[model samples]
Target: MRPARALIDLDALRHNYRLARRLGGGKALAVIKADAYGHGAVRCAQALEGEADGFAVAFLEEALALREAGIAAPILLLEGVLAADELPLVAEHDLWMVVHAPWQVEALARATLPRPLDVWLKLDSGMHRVGIDAEAYATTWQRLRALPQVGGLVKMTHFSRADEPDHERTREQIDTFAAVTAGLPGETSLCNSPALLAWPQARGDWARAGLMLYGASPFAHGHAAGAQLQPVMTLESQVIAVRDLPAGEPVGYGGTFVAPRPTRVGVVAMGYADGYPQFAATGTPVAIDGRPGRLIGRVSMDMLTVDLTDHPDAGVGSRVELWGRQVAATEVVARSQTSAYRLLCGVKRVPLVSVGG
Candidate 1:
């Protein structure tokens, strides 16, 4: 059986971390959340352990998982606690929390803890997603800080349009973040990946890098050299079958892609089940037999077919790169009409061999 594989390049990951450090020019937290964007949290974190200032995850469970894995690095919980009960664990594990709501503030004020907690005050600069609005930020910060459980405070905000380098929204968010925490006595974190790469001004006291570490550009149309990144994960599969199709013969379920001419096709031993995207329509690119080809059918549950007419030498058992070094995830994301964040996080139920071959 063909084993669908994700070859994670630790060197690439480290290089990206270095890039973030150079560009951030300050403390940099690797956002190893989402299982390090489906690259495996424990492995990715362990690889970055010595070099990174800290690792940032979405919740306490993720932090605890890393801790249980012998990961001794400091962890920042970007989403903070969901329930009042999670507070003790947060304190016990020394996990930094991003207190964004009144309930959390109240809970922190109530929780009895042995050690003070570091807090990253999340201000709703513009996204208006999960953060406490700027107007109420100070009061909330003051309340959270008043708790004997609180240690140092840090201000943070997520960008709504940093991915679009030309969008004025990033500037607006920066201004709002600045205006809210102008003289506040705390460190500030503003940049995500795009900000860290493109908006030099967004690099504050710290930057939380997410997509960039996996070698995906946060800005649209940004290239590897332009963003100064390295490709971290390369997903590959093998062809299990090959056949010829007559002109106009429909391929795959629902006739998603009809052969334009007498075309050769190779069925790869990978599909949605192996983390290959399901909605990836025909014409999505793939590397077949070490050659570039196009996916020619609807992505199936167990496998997907690719056009091999362009590569006459392609055959069964040939290696196929769904997305990776040569066939960048950015390229896949563009063809799939999705983001690298989704693509990387979407990888599931597949054996990802980290440290590369």
Candidate 2:
């Protein structure tokens, strides 16, 4: 078998969920959308089965998959029903929905279900993504509350700048959500991973832990002081070849990197085809035999070259970690001008091995 495989540490996943719960001080929904951000939703959900207060997904299909996996915990459809026809499936699966648009409100009002649906009313405080305007929030809330089909209601709004701790936008959003939903007869959820970590005040009735639940820091500035999260997925591969190139010799496509001195380059068995970032430039961090190394040239479809001069002992069969404990996904992506979320969710074609559930 190819030595390129992703090792998923389920223990770290559960630990992160527990940390999210501790920080939120309330019910926390493990955001398992995008196939649990490429960590495998079914496996991650099963790992957090009895631990997480609930699970949140981008759409109804994801919720259905979790339900099929026998996950009994509440599954929330973050985007809610896409069309009126999906209402029956929402009710049939007893899924919680996030009513973000007026059309969704209209659909719910027009349809009669076997059971009342629990809904989270979303307000577009500042994100301007997919939410009702603050001006329409109160009226929408009242209208949804009056609907016999609506069983429980929760006020929710997403933060656009919560990752930037110094930014005033998150604070403004929090205040706006408060002002719009004040005295409202329902629970509230405004914190995504970043808000829940940086702004304690943003934590409401339900905290949605997305990237953090996969054991990565949500802040661009790096891990918070007290919030130390263990990495859950370690992307590893073996060194398939090692070459000693003479000075002035070029490496990889485009000759992006030329040896300034006699350099030892180790070819790893994983690449963009396996979801490794293609634009990752020279000097991106990697680990050879658990020691530090730097990506030396352009990433190829099935291979990437790493500077193995410092680790002269590293050769064929040596372990190479693309990202995890030693080289963080956050660090690797930062060098590549991308986000950890993309790296995590973009992983495809690579086999996964789960450990320590």
Candidate 3:
């Protein structure tokens, strides 16, 4: 097989985690969900174990996967208990759960366990997601507090748009969240990756960050490249074939790129199947032998051709970075009409091997 792969800079992972702590100025829970958002949960959790206070995932299976990998640190399930029968495994595994709905509360309130389960209550300050309303927030907190089946309860909520620092909606969310649990009990978690990095006010007793630790900017407007944040995952492939096409020769599917002039086209061993965005525009950037290059056709399921006529040194077996230190994944995501979060997590078949663990 080719060396096409995603090299993860784990040292940068620690730095980004610490960045969250530094910016938020509070306890931080590294949100390592979606397999650490495609960084591999076991691998990411190990890198983040000692540095972060804990890790939060979408549900129980992800937490259990980490446990299977011998990760003993705290892991919180952001989605909470998926079933009442699994509470034993949760308690046995020492995994914390988030209670978002009334049934989850009632399930815990009625279950008889060896002791109370560690849980966090989800508050719907805004976003209008799965969280309970303010009225329910107060009542459920009190009710869950009284239940011996539930252990320490933490307050948690998701941010709608912390990426856009100038957006007033985030301000409204912070204010509403503060108002909801102003005088209530236990620590609170409001900040995600963007909030942890930008909104100092959103930092609560605890914060759950998902993206920044991966070194990709969640900000849709611009990035703080001056802050010294480094990219974590570098996805690179190589040219498997190269051909000099005559003028007007179309390239790839549907002839998306009909060369205006004779051109040198190279097919790189990456496509949507390899996690490269299928919708990557014709002019989307790629890097060949450390030189800037551009994809010239539709991103196929297995391979995509890039226009490499400008690089005299470029040839078959040459290195090509889809996105990384050389080609920013954020920039590609922008050109692909998608977000880095989706692009990073959507990668398949490409192994994420650690570069600087």
- Per TM-score, the best of the predicted structures is 2
lDDT of 2 by residue, 92-204 (tens): 99999999999999999999799999999999999999999988999999999999999999999999998899999999999999999988877889989898789998989
Report lDDT per candidate.
0.87, 0.92, 0.85
TM-score of each: 0.96, 0.98, 0.97
Cα lDDT tens digits for candidate 3, 207-293: 777888888888775756314567888999899999999998899889988998889999999989888898899889989999899
Clashing pairs in 2: none
Stretches of model 3 off by over 4 angstroms after superposition = 225-227
Sorted on TM-score, highest at the top, how do the candidates line up?
2, 3, 1
What is the C-alpha local distance difference test score of candidate 1?
0.87
- Indicate whether candidate 1 or candidate 2 has the larger lDDT: 2
Write candidate 1's Cα lDDT for 224-274 as tens digits.
434578889989988889999999999989997888899998988888887
Candidates 1 and 3 compared: the better one by lDDT is: 1
